[model samples]
Target: MENGTNTQSEGKDPSGFLSKIIGNPVMVKLNSGVVYKGKYFTRELQSVDGYMNIALEKTEEYVDGTKRRSYGDAFVRGNNVMYISADS
Candidate 1:
């Protein structure tokens, strides 16, 4: 049972998933609860070091679901990233 599940999951390439959304707008949320929205940059995602470099066009620092601050273009490290999702 476990082997079957592992094979099924292994068949799905995470990089393939990321490639599909490259160049599209994406939202990145960090472990710190900060969110960044911008066009997904594919080049940085290829980094083997696990450092996510986002071409930040907008950012929202959240504190208990409330936005505390906003900002423009910036780059974020991958270690802090919690998840990346496609932004409408």
Candidate 2:
């Protein structure tokens, strides 16, 4: 490319969707059937990465729909994450 510039078409990006949900409540489920409900993604998240690794504040853990415990801040590895749902 001539002046170090080029143009190409790419697909839709999900980063915008992720960014929009910052400071909102969400429920995150892990592959092990554990669920974590908390305030979702933000600067303190530490690493909301490509694998979906998550960090949260004011987190509550749930097991089989039963509240188990709470954490002031929580970190979960992305590999175990099943899905993340935003609160309505």
Candidate 3:
């Protein structure tokens, strides 16, 4: 590795299913019964950290099945996230 550059290839799906949903629409459900929707997830994916926390763009927040707010960017804490799926 020269100049701090190692010629290591990244896994095609290093983030597992997340690789499929980077730009697709998604629905994220939280344990508190709150839901967030965004432009996609791999079931549709954004960015997932080791702890499973997610960062999303163009997101909307929902409560009791009603749209409550919107965010240009949003972060979902891993512990609060119940599930994430492609928006269909």
Q: Return the top candidate by lDDT.
A: 2
lDDT of 3 by residue, 1-88 (tens): 4587744554332364566667778888999999999864333244476667887779999999999999988878888988878786
Report the lDDT of model 3 for residue 45: 45
lDDT, candidate 3, at 46: 45
Predict model 3's lDDT versus the native.
0.76
Clashes of each: 1, 0, 10
lDDT of 1 by residue, 16-42 (tens): 556678777777788987776676545
Better of 1 and 2 by TM-score: 2
**lDDT per model, in order?**
0.65, 0.80, 0.76
Show where candidate 2 strays beyond 4 Å: 1-13
Give one digit per residue, the lDDT tens place, for model 2 in 26-74: 8889999999999965785546767777888899999999999999999
The C-alpha local distance difference test score for the whole of candidate 2 amounts to 0.80
- Between candidates 1 and 3, the TM-score winner: 3
Per-model TM-score, in order, reads: 0.59, 0.78, 0.71
Decoy 2 TM-score against native: 0.78
Better of 1 and 2 by lDDT: 2
